[model samples]
Target: MENITFNHIYTLGNIVFENEIYKHYHYPEMLVRYDSNFLAFKKMPSIDEFKAAFTYLRNYHMKHGQSHVKFTFPENQKPPEGFLEYLNDNDFLYGYNELYEIQPDQFPRLKDNPDININPVTAENLDAFLTLQYTFDEEYGEEFAKQKVALHNRNFKDEQIMQVLAYYRGLPAGSVDIIISEDTAEIDQLSVLDTMQRKGIGGRLQKFVMDHFPQKTIILVADGNDTPREMYQKQNYQYVGFKYECIKVFE
Candidate 1:
């Protein structure tokens, strides 16, 4: 986060977490976030320090107790060959993958199903949305959701978070956050919790947004292998580009 222009919610600054060992950021729900490419640590690491660094990361996740925190290292800063093994030893479900950007038209045509009833994420339904988000993560990205919620609850704004918690039939089923930067509207952080999957909730949620916003270009990040890619492709979204998930070494 150093040398970058952004509104940081982390008082420890956009550097490391309070303990100094775990480096992270509190991303607003709708806004796209990226590391400044500024190294979280001072230098490339020696093998001896790898254990301690991974330990710190593990503790960092435990301390925060929820939500997945991502540390982006430069593509050139390689970890020791056994680094991922170290993470596995600590029960970290680590997977390296691509972040694909899909366009709206590519997503499926809405069944326009009657099973779904979409609504705004107001303060009255925040807890439901949060709970729904938890269930969603548990089903699809349980561990990742834990870290994400933990970090999100502690470090993000109530209103901003609500913006990502739109309701469906009085239950928190899914959400798509909207952000206006300069002249463009960025659609992001869309999530449909578990128990609601395949219920047409996601399509309904987004379709409602499109109904209100027909001319806007919706944007977001999805795992290259996530099944949601099929959904996005059905939404008429073209693959504009991609963002790499590189390793961020803090040594």
Candidate 2:
């Protein structure tokens, strides 16, 4: 098998993003996902080009009813000189995300529980899946929750996305959505209820998915400042790289 490269990961990530966003603009210097109000550069550009890119993105998004927008620069790509200064001068909120990947051999196997069952979500249990998904979004505020609801409404029908649900002793405990590409499996939106955390539910759900794609590389992105990154580290996921993001949410 060929070794998985960052470029492969980058391309797959954009595929996933495009599906969720629905519309996009692919420019030589950057790719923009419209409905999500997001953009990312393939590589750094000259200061004049960078400024023009920003102006183009802002104008396009604003015309489309998105007042606020976000841009991400992958660590694998060179950051243009003065990129940070530009963000600061514009008063954009900034953050980073850690990208992790793993192979089957490195996947951890947790103790099996006869009481726990993880299964692919089907139409029969679709409502149950939505309940947990919406519950997970509650903390993020109503607007975020609404956005998630809309995303999932579209995502559930996408053939590339595999939805899994975990039941603990006959009750829904957690769920995950895996985005499948030709050679890689990217886990998107893995969530476990607060009351279900630390009971091995999350690990079992992850392992269940890993078992399905033994020959493919698994990928996920974690917030650089979040505890989930620590949990992923414990699962033996390699930190390949990260991307810094600049976001401005219009009031």
What tens-digit string does per-residue lDDT give for candidate 2 at 51-163? 76667667876675556666666565545547777778878877777788899779887887898899898889988888888898878666667667766766789888898
lDDT of each: 0.48, 0.73
Best by lDDT: 2
User: What TM-score would each prediction reach against the true structure?
Assistant: 0.52, 0.82
lDDT of 1 by residue, 8-74 (tens): 1112224435333334444343112233211243344444554566456546544544234344333
Note the residue pairs that clash in candidate 2: none
Backbone-clash count (model 1): 35
- The local lDDT score (0 to 100) that residue 175 gets in candidate 1 is 76
- Evaluate residue 83 in candidate 2 and report its C-alpha lDDT on the 0 to 100 scale: 71
For candidate 2, the C-alpha RMSD (Å) to the true structure equals: 5.2
